[model samples]
Target: MRITEPYTIFLRRLPSGKSVYYYQFRDEDGKRSPAYSTGTNKIAQARRVCQRLYNEGKFKKSNEILFKTFASGFFDDESDFCKWKEVNGSSLAKSTIASYKRLLENQILPFFGSMKLKKINTDTVKRWIVWCSEKCSAKTSNNAQSVFNIIMKSAKEKKLISEVPSSELAFRKIKKKERELLTVEELNRIYHSPLWGWECARRAFLTCAITGMRIGEITGLQTFEVGDDRLNVEHTLHPKFGLGPTKTRVCRFVPIPKSLGLKRQCGKTWAFEKPTEEKPCRADYIYGKLMLICDSLGIDHKARGITVHSLRNMFISYMRGSSFGETIDLKIKAVVGHADESMTDWYTYWKPEMFPEIYEIQEKLFKEITEV
Candidate 1:
């Protein structure tokens, strides 16, 4: 039996012999919502919830806002959502905001842009998920799904929707591919080669190889942070956000051989500044030089997925497996600023002189590369 005057209530029975109460209510425009769960088995409680929500005008509120219009101001500093996040002490970085905006424009808005927030439901979101799988890689599809959920959750928090559409399905799984890392011989070749005339980028790549600095860290490295035998890492350069905190937001001091010949200045001048300009060189520029060197040396750069980041991977692998760095995994993590909370105490009390093996390892590793 169905009660159809003010609203309709029904019980859906599961195979396990449990019944759930669901309801459908009409809006001001006479549009009925998809059956929403009251999350109770008791019909009396379900009726009270439905009546209370309808009286509060939640049934009519969702009709006025379009998904695209609401999403347009999602991360803007002036938006209520941004203010709410700030008040709660969870403000997102500009780079993260930019990434979310790209996902909205490219993946989300194309399908949901014209749809009403009220009309977005589980089936609709599932269809979008299938579409994303067909169009994007598994990882990228997952990112799109995550961003959409965040938007729906925000809408629900603001009372724009009764509840966020549940994508209860698991995100698509990505098959992990083994990234190609530079070998000792290949590294020696790269170190000795001219790097297609990109001297500064070559230095940056070598720094990452020996000290395990990320390309972004190299881009943001300041002259004052360098010392006679070690460099302090405090910030990283985002392509769009410029200088900001490192990826893990943890600062580290890494030992480097003085033979690397990195010079220190008084203030915050970039250590890897372009010769022609005072600005830090682009990561893409460094990557391009690496690709060019790989080509010139007959290395399978593209087929093997080699890139500038391979330098850091090489460093980590060598340090973790080498005899000198065998028992110092925690120190290795501290040196590279790996994000592990269990090692926080070790990272806190770190000093360059505390780990003499790393200096010896550095000296042996860079001895060939630094020699003329």
Candidate 2:
């Protein structure tokens, strides 16, 4: 009855003419379990069944399993991973959860769907990153890595895997080029191009420039969010998900220019009529309009040379060159809804109107530089 390493089962013939087989093994966790195979008189077949039970940790009626395998088992039990995401993704923002669902649908599930959780490893993850990088942008690749890391980390926290591969190993770096802000001349060219003719496209780009708001913030704007002589940057409309809080989760207001003719229609409503519920304007809608304008203007939409985000950068650059030079950083941060201003060394009390003087100075500098 001595059971040692490489233990074997011996079939014993009972008085009833029945044979029994036994098998045992030490798991990676150093636990042992035994099981009986079918009434095969053959030792090898019993040994094979024993090995299968041992590897799967199903030898005993009740043995705790690794979290990784447990999650995989759960995944197998249900065809849809969205249920798991919703249950486990509570900590993530709604928009983030939606994005995770998309990534899983478009990328993760397609490759790993049939595989057991225990089977996923550094090599497989790295290959997935390579594939994602080939088909997507560097930012997209990074986002996918982030989402995958979060899911795996959640799995590990719940004891799905013994350990998660180091993030350094899981994510491959894709070098991104520095983004250049658009010049005034270039901005003029882009604005004059037929692509900028759409009201939404023109309004979205101009709003970003004037208020230094992110594209999301600009696109999420509702007539209700606009106050007398000011626009609020409180929320953003995600491309895939609907309206959510701003990226920084902080709200700020930008002074509306008289040029836009924004006024209060009556006691409770602002001058800009609120969009109808049936067709509420969204960031993606604005972006689509901008893309259409670019196409009509024959601009290279895919080129890294120019982007809608450049409007915000241009606003920053222009503000920095104004009389509010010293306070430009803080002012920009305030209007742009940046959460912190440690990197920007200006007092926070400055008003957005101070940008006008800076704009005047920038105009002079621009004239001197361009001689136009």
Candidate 3:
């Protein structure tokens, strides 16, 4: 049926004696199409449902339509929305920007990128979801939709459209993957094991496992940021993005409980300095190289959930001491930098000397309760 064709609606009484709404329309062959249920008892919502369906269905196109009048940009790479933020001296994370570009290149562009902004609505989104379903898993398709939603939401913010196209959109269920953490013994086994030839990588991993700092924080750590019994997560570095903000987009301190004695006092200032040379490695480097050591240790990284970041998982699991409530009782949040501590405090009263006192009880609790 041509989407632009006129549609008519009527009410039908169900066996339960409740009335429901449905819409009927004509097809391209001048044939009457079957009545489609709007699935709502409310007439207003039902009309919205019918309108949304019409917006998404196959429709006639005009070759005379101007492309420039449709949308200022089509794909993620073309958006140039980053320029808006760059002018403000701040920009969205490169990882998020990359995800948008990847989603557009891989899936979103094929279905909706070329379509006019006026043509993109909930109904077309449903068709796009179904189209993505043909090639990828439900989760990946949903991720693509999320990326599309972000782009549309950006357009809405810029006043390109009256509203976000997918504001009312809902996606199919996404199955969760099972993620397991290593036990304390398994952690020790890996920590003490040979570095499979690279020295700093193992130490970097073990520091994350014991202290619960993110891998990026550990890899990009400067020796000055290391203390007698705590590691400072002041910055993180990425391969493509270069040295940048942490996942939380702020500097934080992660406790290095005296139990591990992760001393970074050495020739180089940065932790895990160039593994083969004398320069510090980026966060991505640590994430990329660990699988080789995993192979050497005869560990199946995927089966074991043993990425460099999973070392933080191991730290978290061991910190809780087999009880969920202990996480709060032990104040594990502050130790792991999960505390809602203000970044403003950095300017207010940030002293590396003051942390040892502020975290005094945490240090004792960590050494007392930590499994390893």
Which numbered prediction scores highest in TM-score against the true structure? Answer: 1
Which lDDT value does model 2 have at 64?
44
Tens-digit lDDT string for candidate 2 (173-198)? 66766666656665555555555433
Provide the lowest-lDDT 10-residue window in model 1: 260-269
> lDDT of all the models against the reference?
0.80, 0.58, 0.63
**What ordering of candidates by TM-score runs from best to worst?**
1, 3, 2
The root-mean-square deviation over C-alpha atoms between each candidate and the true structure, in angstroms, is: 11.7, 13.0, 15.1
Residue-wise C-alpha lDDT for candidate 3, range 27-141, written one tens digit per residue:
4454566676666789898887667545544211222122232222433332346665667765667775776667777887777656676667777888888889898899778
> TM-score per candidate, in order?
0.74, 0.58, 0.65
CA error at residue 25 for candidate 3, angstroms: 39
Query: Which residue runs of candidate 1 sit more than 4 Å off their true CA positions?
Result: 1-60, 84-90, 166-169, 195-198, 264-268, 324-326, 340-349
Q: Best lDDT goes to which candidate?
A: 1
Clashing pairs in 1: none
Note the residue pairs that clash in candidate 2: 67-159, 67-160, 68-160, 68-161, 195-293, 263-271, 322-358, 323-358
- Please give the range of 10 consecutive residues that has the lowest summed lDDT in model 3: 58-67
Work out candidate 1's RMSD over C-alphas: 11.7
Name the lDDT of candidate 3.
0.63
